[model samples]
Target chain A: MIPIDYYIIVSILLFSIGSAIVFTRRNILYVLMGIELIFNAANINLVAFGQLDPYLNGQLFSMLIITVAAAESVVALAIVIVLFKKLNTIDLNEITQLKEK
Target chain B: MKLIEIVFFFFAIQLLSSALVILFTRNVVYAAIALMSTLLGVAALFVVAGSDLLAVVQLVVYVGGVLILLLFGVLYTYRDPESYFEKKHVLLSIVTVVCIAGALLFLLSDLPFNYPQLETSPHDATGITKRTGYLWITNNLLVFEVVAVFLLVVLVGAGWIASHVLDKSKKDV
Candidate 1:
């Protein structure tokens, strides 16, 4: 039988990769994918805990997280599209016109 | 090894490989597809963990909705794949991964590892579905309604923004 630690380790690795992508990627879409990855990592933890809890609240919370993630992606992609059209590029490094002086 | 172990091993391999592809790929579209595979593999993991509801929602919301929108956004916005490949920051990414992994290891290392004994009863598929629906309506009804309304608003807003941008671009051209 595979121990639960194995799952936890895999989730940790994924979460770390996602965080790296979020912090280092210049592309807006890649950053959004990173956010999705982070959300998935949280969901994995929720479900793992749900397996132990008798009431299944963790699973319920994961459902809510899924819904919220969907809405967030929709709004974020819309913003990305608008930014792409305006700047002709989606690289975060190039869109620094809003940087504090 | 048992069938469940074999299935889990295969799923874990697929999940990790797809995650690596998503992180390493230069093409945005390919990364999106890799992400879709990764999401599906995670959903399968949820199933293995005995959270069938989470698995279904993960499949429907992440794989079906979020990933599709991401793919469409990439197709509509980016024209050249090579353009995205420029400005590689592999060293920074590796550093970030190492630091975050080290921190997470420190934080989670002391977590208890006692496997709780699951009280097994007859698996009533219908019971889970029925209870989930009841709980959604009774306990989380407000949240459910808010999410539905939020999704509708997002749909309208995105449509409006997309068309407005298209029209403005056309005028400028």
Candidate 2:
């Protein structure tokens, strides 16, 4: 079996790249995808560490994480839909009404 | 040189490359497809780690549910696709990512985590799925209930947020 350390590296890489996606992307939809990437990165870490335990707590935690992530995305997409309708645009750059003048 | 090692390497490579695609792609359609690849790779890795149940959950929820919803959302908000990525910060973001990954790798390498190197993962263990279900009901029951309610609230809340507001606005117009 591969050492648990390798999984950590992969998780870290996924995490940093996911952050890059969130940081650099302007589209609300692409940002959501990046958030999903970040979520999966953590899930990978949990599943990897779950191997050390007999009860599989890590897998259980990851299951909950996945469930919440799905629900979160549903609400986010709903907001995106409404935002598109109201503003006629979904670009994060252009929707800056919240910015102070 | 073992099959397990080969498959592990495949998961690692596919995950990293597809994630990079999500980072760099300017086209939203290609980025969405690439996210699908990344999610599939994560599911495979879950199987390799001996959790077939979570692997399947990852598939049904992420690839089937989330990706499709994203595609539908994209269809609704269709525009001439623009730079999801910031062209100006390309080099800066790359440098930041490299720094963060390097720092995390360095920090994580020192953590003591000792486990048996099982030649065959417990992937084929009998009744693992059964055990998972039992444990959920027996031990993690609270999480099960809360998420159930959470999803219900989300369903109604999302409908109200997405639909009801639009109707009021349309009436006003």
Candidate 3:
């Protein structure tokens, strides 16, 4: 079996890539995808660390996180669709800022 | 050298590279598809970590549910493929990614690498599903139930928001 360090390093790399995607991408859907990547990275860490725990608390929490991420994506994407319909574009910079007339 | 080690590295490559593709690919559809492979690779990682249950859930929820939603969003929103993908601050993001990775490795290098070998057998003797179920109904029951309530709320809220939009558009007509 490989050391836990391998998993940890991969998780760190995934998290970094996710962060980069979040910051650099202008498409809101890609931004949502980046958020999912970040969530999965954290899930990997939880499972890897849970392997060290006899009770598997980390795994339980990982399950919780998975459920939450799924729900979050649903709501966020719904919002994205709504925004796209109203704004005509999903580019982060192109979307008009909120201001009252 | 070992089979498991080989599998782990294979998935690790799949996960990392697909993630890179997802970030760099200009085609929104290609990026969405790349995310599928990335999630599957992560599920394999869970198996390597000895959590079969998590692997299955990751596959189901991420690959099946979330990726589908993302692809649908792509289909529904973009009329012209040219305008579908937009990236900003490329060089800055690259520098930030490299800096973050390097700093993390530097931090890791300073820490002692030794870890105590687990006392138990390599695999969990107890079935994780059973244990997870027990925990779900007992200690984690509250949180688990709360999640259910949260899902219900989100479901109703999404429906409400959607119908509200339709009503407004109809009135505008």
Return the TM-score for each candidate structure.
Answer: 0.87, 0.93, 0.93
Q: What is the lDDT of residue B162 in candidate 2?
A: 85
| lDDT accuracy of residue B153 in candidate 3 | 97
Q: Candidate 3's residue-wise lDDT over A1-101, tens digit each?
A: 46778888998899888988898887888888889999999999898878877677999999989999998898888777777767777888877674311
The residue pairs that clash in candidate 3, if any, are: none
- Candidate 3, B60-172: lDDT as tens digits: 88899989999999998875655644345557668868987889888987998666656442347764777777889988889989999998998889777767876776687
What TM-score does chain A reach in every model? 0.89, 0.93, 0.92
In candidate 2, what are the lDDT values of residues B1-173, reduced to their tens digit?
Answer: 88887999998999899999878777788888999999999999988887889999999999999999999997888777653445676786698689889998888778766677665546455725887899899898998998899999998999999889799878988
- Expressed as tens digits, the lDDT of each residue in A17-98 for candidate 2 is 9888788778898889989999999999999888666787898999999999999999999989878878888888888783
List residue ranges in candidate 3 displaced over 4 A: A98-101, B79-81, B84-90, B112-115, B119-123
- Candidate with maximal TM-score: 2
Sort by DockQ, best first: 2, 3, 1
Relative to the true structure, how large is the alpha-carbon lDDT of every model? 0.79, 0.85, 0.84
**Can you give the lDDT of residue A22 in candidate 3?**
92
Cα lDDT tens digits for candidate 1, A1-101:
34567677778888988988888777889999999989888888777766665556777788888888988888888878777777777888788774222
On lDDT, the leading prediction is 2
What TM-score does structure 1 among the candidates reach? 0.87
lDDT score, residue B21, model 1? 83
lDDT of 1 by residue, B13-99 (tens): 898788878777788888898998899899888777766777887887788889889999888887576665545567777788779
How many clashes does the backbone of model 1 have?
0
Better of 2 and 3 by TM-score: 2
Residue pair clashes in candidate 2 = none
